[model samples]
Target: MNAFLKFMKRNYKIVALVVLLAGALFGFTMIPGQKENDPDKDKLLIELLTYVIEKGHYNPAAIDDTFSKGVYKDYLENIDPSKRFFTQADINEFSKYETQLDDQINNRDLSFFYLTYGRLQQRIKEANSFYKDILAKPFDFKADESFNTDYEKMPFAKDDAELRDRWRKQLKLSVLSSVADKEKMQDAPAEDKLKDKEKGFSDEKALEAKPGADVNKTKANGEKKSFTELEKEARESTLKSLNDYFDFVGDLKQEEWFSIYMNAIAERFDPHTYYFAPDDKDKFDTSMRGSLEGIGARLQKKNDFVEISELIPGGPAWRGKELEQGDLIMKVAQGKDQPVDISGMRLDDVVKKIKGPKGTEVRLTVKKVDGSVKTIAITREVVEIEETYAKSSIVKKGGKTYGVIYLPKFYIDFENQDNRDAAKDVAAEVDHLKAQGVDGIVMDLRDNGGGSLKTVVDIAGLFIEKGPVVQVRSRAEDGKPSDKPEVLTDNDPKVHYDGPLVVLINNFSASASEIFAAAIQDYNRGLILGSKQSYGKGTVQNIIDLNRFVRGSTFGNLGALKTTTQKFYRINGGSTQREGVKSDIIMPDKYSYIEIGERDSDNALPWDKIAQAPYKPFKNNFAPAIANSKKRIAESAEFKLMDENAKFLSERKDDNNYSLNIDKFKADAAKIEVAAKKFKALGKYNSNLTFDALPYEKEKFKNDPALAEKKKDWYESLGKDAYVNEALNVLDDLQPKGGKTASTEAKKETRIKTR
Candidate 1:
């Protein structure tokens, strides 16, 4: 409460008057124990959160004003990520309590929250009018204006007029895409709309078309959409989007906002330490359940649109092969019902619309990467965990077959030990591939975010004889490692699939993936190749149900806290906390130049080293293999194209200065389109690597032609993967014609370069 004291000293009279008023409003409670409409449960929750964060967090920050400042910043940023809502005056008014939040949190005071919430409500109402007023009049397309999307670089509006102007510019930028599409419509040749006028639009996205007016009127007639007509459509669309967004926002209760505030406080300890509300916990469980009756696309909110981040393999969407990743879902329909536009819908709400009972049909209108909209329908099924788990395929090149396995995540069923774990399942896959008589193994851990720590050791044991794989260090009362470092290892001496190995990783490979990759690299057990490094997530978390800590409370659903408890260190002293696992032979890809690792995260723990864990290093023949692979990557056209793609994307990402003027916007859009085409060639790269499903899968698919087609497409994509082809070439270089392990070779010490 040093900040409180300092403020009081500077303006004692003002502070005392404000305190008296705040006290009067807060049920005039002298003890700060109770409030109007706020139950004791919430107070208990606050106390519990503070206590758990302080005692349970691996390295808790001091709960002072400095910490309070961090919470203040986090809370404001969470609420205003784009700096589009609050103005300078609003920020100034809220800044008064910037330092006093620590005292308030400790005092169990929520007056500051009420104050900010009330102001935000007022500001939102103000913004609603601002956009409506701007959209009411015609926007001058010929006006020379530019919008800067680097929100960090933009200042808050100085006044209401400036705020309205800011809204006008933003709204113009938002409609640029629709305006450009309208222009394209103006340029297109007339279509035979009479032949197919609304013929196939029965299951299309719901549109607010005028009664008896042809929805495809533009396509039917040679006449183009007038500028005024485009303007009306764009403005109405924006208004609807804003209204829907506000409607969604209106559904959230004060408890949710308080949860955000509390989370902001908790995150000062670390990024991973999070408070999961009851609903959030349920959603987490659903996601972790691995299989659900859905279309099976991972959706992420990108502004107003819900973009497909991933298509779960073997799911309905993947089987259809029509819906790809990076597609933006605009609308969702169920059983031929009038489609509901899902843009501006909450992600959870959108997911609910897409998922249904197994065998139900769902239609989606998605905007593809090429800026074309298409409708895709799929019969939903229960996507199994097996699709996400270890699956091996044979890749043949130069008359040699190599085993390739892709581990999506180190998955584990927390509620059931009988459920398949990554380590066990992967080891089983290894035995199966060995049975196929594969010469070498290429384990793909790209995009694997990791799972159970016990599983990490188990999986590590499959490649090594017996040694410490990782060291766990915890925070103690003192400023040093309090607990003695526990080395997690496998005592099992049997090594499964001890052949020429190449572990494929990317920037997205993290946590348990990093642990396994680091172990392989540390022991020189295999050649690590992909992005420069893996996702450096070396910390561990334990979910603590808050209900277990409290008793005899009438309160329901106390929820849980996923708190960071420890950090994992590689055998040779380096913690993969931030630096991640380095690849022996780096290959360029899309995320090569992106800040996607744990190091980019706010409040992330710093990288450090502990005493080395004693272990016997394995001998590997990756030196010449890495050299040869590097030479191939340097010479290959696909690799050069990929490098260029990475640079182009990085440049685009860095250039956030967007033009609001039509000509400039069109010019930038054209440049982006051309650049996007160049990267498209990377997807078409074929290494002539042939892949075959396992015998069991092959036999099973024989009875199901649909499933067989899905498998065929997946294997063919593996054939097109240039990275996988290079990985196989590296394996060939490592294990000559005999195709055997070099484990019998003399052990040589190799120090990995630290970033």
Candidate 2:
């Protein structure tokens, strides 16, 4: 359900409150010495996780030999991403449990965990030793060799020499980018240097010191180091990286590994049925809380390093104006303390260090978007994740102003119904835009992974004089009162600002977003645009706190499991599961050709349909809007370039094997870089769209420079959005003759703002 991407925006809070409410009503005092860390909790956890999966999951697969083998396969791939850790002999030995994990779980045995953990320890030790040995010798950058970054193409090494060669080639590739960057830095002007000289010490010295090498050596001529020396530094960097990997691995406990094993088992059922450890559960809750007392940045792990994916608008990080997407977090420090190198740290562990009580300050050594590094300080505060809520602005085109509501998620506070929600926020924004005499409205739901189901129903009702919006089908179960498919209708006869409407969606729009989009499309209430389809995630999940199931025991903190409980269906008798909501006008984007969404997921629910909900479709459906958009989109050069870029990226992704030869590598990279230059013109493709913050936002922006900058960036991006530009064309075409509510047989076209 795009759960990974929507963690902070939606899902989390809904899940947490559901459990928190359940716990508060049912929980008893914990037994003395029986807290989550109790020794007996491991077996208890397995008992709980297994019970939940079997009893509560919508469709739990049999934990037979096939399932056990699947778990074994997933474990190997994730634990050793490169497939270099274990040999054929080791695999053969471990294959004994390939079909026994199911039985082991049933018996409450930790033998499999014990065996794998022990063997993995030996492998990591041996692999680190091999990496060190490989680093001891100089690598020939010009050597005619190649490595496959795609691990699926690789098998376990045949023997030790083959394993060492595998390690050697991979390590060489690891340092290639660093070496290239260093080369670029050396030739570039000193004024273009990314980092200041000696914030602490040189990288090479740190690497050598880790391996007991003295760092007192001086350059013989005190001249600039040659390419050869630079390559040496790159290789050393790779070694230090490997050392960090091993160091991080050394701290892995049995419980953590077992949780990974459990997750592997759960993932076999579905992608989103995750098993969170206690610490991870805590983090999940914090994310669901929405605003945390921290720097307020969304971070993601990119390979071995953590990179800032986004900054919560109006947060300390955004206000500080230092962090940006793609910036690598090199180190983290508190106050004047020595900064801890977090280059290879766990994402959650690193998060714990950065986030703190409100008012505390944390300093980050950030590698900026331009490869420049700087030390910046941010005072942690209660950072409101405003972007996760509904926000709107006005866009002017063709001498007419249109409303654009960017609803990031279908957010709602289940614990507190009175809390602000997407439905209410959007309703207010729509009224505001209507008051401004907007000719048309564009609702941007791109990257919206969805949130509250109740919010979806409410938001959907705003478009049409409402009937059924979505259908929910629940599998018949023991003790369940209803097993039939049910249609949820919006009883409120309200159509707020029903002027020409447009919805923008992409591969990331899923779950509740899909429901909303499907309803709008099904009802013919709006013109849908963007990618060929929205992310198909029609299933629903329920988070179960395992602690509740094991009452009267001291083994609390059994964590929780989110299981698929039901499937959502559209009112038009179609399932938005694997086959997502099709756009009225299929536009091309970078993700158009990517294998994402429910179809990419293993064991995702199949697309099926129940009886269509009876509802009236729009008579003046603005079917012409689709044709108009398609015409304009076909003529858009930026869209054509985007399709070409998608093709290039698809071909590039399939070409996984890469040359190790320096000359060949550079040639290939340059070829791709040059081809990428074609996309630079994308930003210049203006829609001639002028935007203004709503009156309320306009007033706030006067006192909030950061707010002004955020809106400014958003406005400029809209101008460059060829898809949105086409949507604007669609909007213009669909608007009524006098810029009133779009003409329909209902003749309901009044200066309507139905509440």
Candidate 3:
């Protein structure tokens, strides 16, 4: 799922007005009937972006040497991620524009882009030839060499010979890994071999596996090939993989490359601000709407094959149950039509072939997890990403039924408010839980990356009585925060559910998530539980249609720009920018000791404070629950193991060197496996809690088995979650002594103060 720091629809008009004014003043109108790859379009885009960002961005960065260098470094890295292609000479020649990009952008110059794009094409062609020759023969993995994969720090090749050696080393590492895996597979037991089929072995993966190849499948599978033969087969496999990669790369158009360059400039303002191309803008809209009219399976390029990465729950592919994750798609065909092989095809092109209008049928020839090929036909339909919406489960623990609602994001349909949104769905779930006699509720916001700001306020309203939910500050025309922060409040005085509450969060919970958690903590309406803090993304972005500014322009889709327009603050006056909402009951997690979130980003906005909004805290005390949870966490062996694992991960996070020698590589891997085995019990822990769908949802399972399966999996996962168990225990402690409205005033109040 994609998470964005988007503002409410109400704020769009303000930003749009600013952009419209800037566009009129700048005169971005273009002549109609411009040819493709028009230099005029590029110049207009540069002018439009700079003007819009300066007019609308919350904190626009200065277009100086620093910004120019960042764009230069990021653009180069984006083009050649692996440090392959582009020799030292190329870098030297391009370095001239490192500090001049600022000047070039100001003048609407394309010299830097033109030079780099042309040089990249030449290098790519050269490297394509280099790989074919490098993989023509077996690699000598017996050499005791190591490859340092810190490509960012790795020096570029000085000459053609050095560049060729670089390619040789990279290709050798790939082939060596495959050879080692094949050797182990040959030695593995039949049962182990059967289990390994999940890794997949598509036909396009190797010419040696083809029917007429000298080393056919029968001989390769049944017989133990010598090291020489295995190495040969691996080289062939590596060769095919590279062929597919270059083939995909060759399909890249100038527009695609230009999009990358444009984003490099946009991201200099902040990590979240982006320039979405025409097609990508449509994708962003589809994701925000949480529905797509097509086959609902996510595909990714796996070597030469397109593999099913995930099947969207409740969608046609998921309902069909024929297509599973890890299955490699070989071919696609329309209803009753001949299947077209998609091997070595670009992923976007393949997706176009697979997706169709609703009610149309598409047949897929996929290599299943069991290495068996099968053709399955699935009808295209309007697939709502079930996981993106709010869902609740009934948790039976200690003779008390509590509800756990997992919200992946604060999704909404801006164009259609009547359609389901996270706020509406969550309110409904709360109503359902109350009907089922749930004594408490756990709002799971783990890994949520934020969405509609309006939804966060609405959802927060469900827990507490009428109050200020959050504070928002828009940037003034001078690119400074406004004098008065707007306090967004819940106008409704009705509290939907006033029972014991707990909000679960992690380092990945961001933006709107931080706002919700902060409101709950600030109001003393719930105990914020989970990792050290939520992701600190307090900035709000609004998408501006760039095409709107250009009147009567046939430049072919000017696309859209998402730029930071405002910064939100907790009702308590603190911005969750780099300092996300702190958890009341901190739990041990793998990311606890590691740096992540907005603080880790290079261009993230700074944290600050605003005047606190006027709101009274709920008269509920959560001290006893927090103390009990901390005590349980400190005493439990499960938590102790998790803490140790977190430390272990922190220590090894920077280890990037890997041995090329098979024996050394295997020994290092075994050592890691042994060290990792110490924490294996973490995955096996069972909280002994039974989770089930409510009666309303269970009734619908008869007609939709996919829903039943999804719920079953959710319950199974909940059963293994130690964090949920702790949350439930905290809920137990939070249960009011007299009743739901009981006064804890005499309980010697102990409160966890929030910023």
Best by lDDT: 3
Compute the lDDT of residue 440 as modeled in candidate 1. Answer: 85
TM-score of each: 0.83, 0.82, 0.83
Checking candidate 1 for backbone clashes, the offending pairs are none
Runs with alpha carbons beyond 4 Å of true place in candidate 3: 1-10, 26-33, 199-221, 283-388, 414-417, 552-554, 701-706, 739-755
Query: Whole-model lDDT, candidate 1?
Result: 0.71
Better of 1 and 3 by lDDT: 3
In terms of lDDT, the poorest run of 10 residues in model 2 is 205-214
Candidate 2 TM-score, C-alpha based: 0.82
After superposing candidate 2, which stretches have Cα over 4 Å from the reference?
Answer: 1-41, 189-224, 287-347, 353-384, 415-418, 479-483, 551-556, 702-706, 738-740, 743-755
lDDT of 2 by residue, 533-611 (tens): 9878888887777766545766546777877766788998888999898898889986666676688766676787777
TM-score of 3: 0.83
How well does candidate 3 score on lDDT at residue 140? 74
Q: Candidate 1 on 219-258: residue-level lDDT in tens?
A: 3465677767776776666666666666666776667666
Tally clashes: model 2: 1
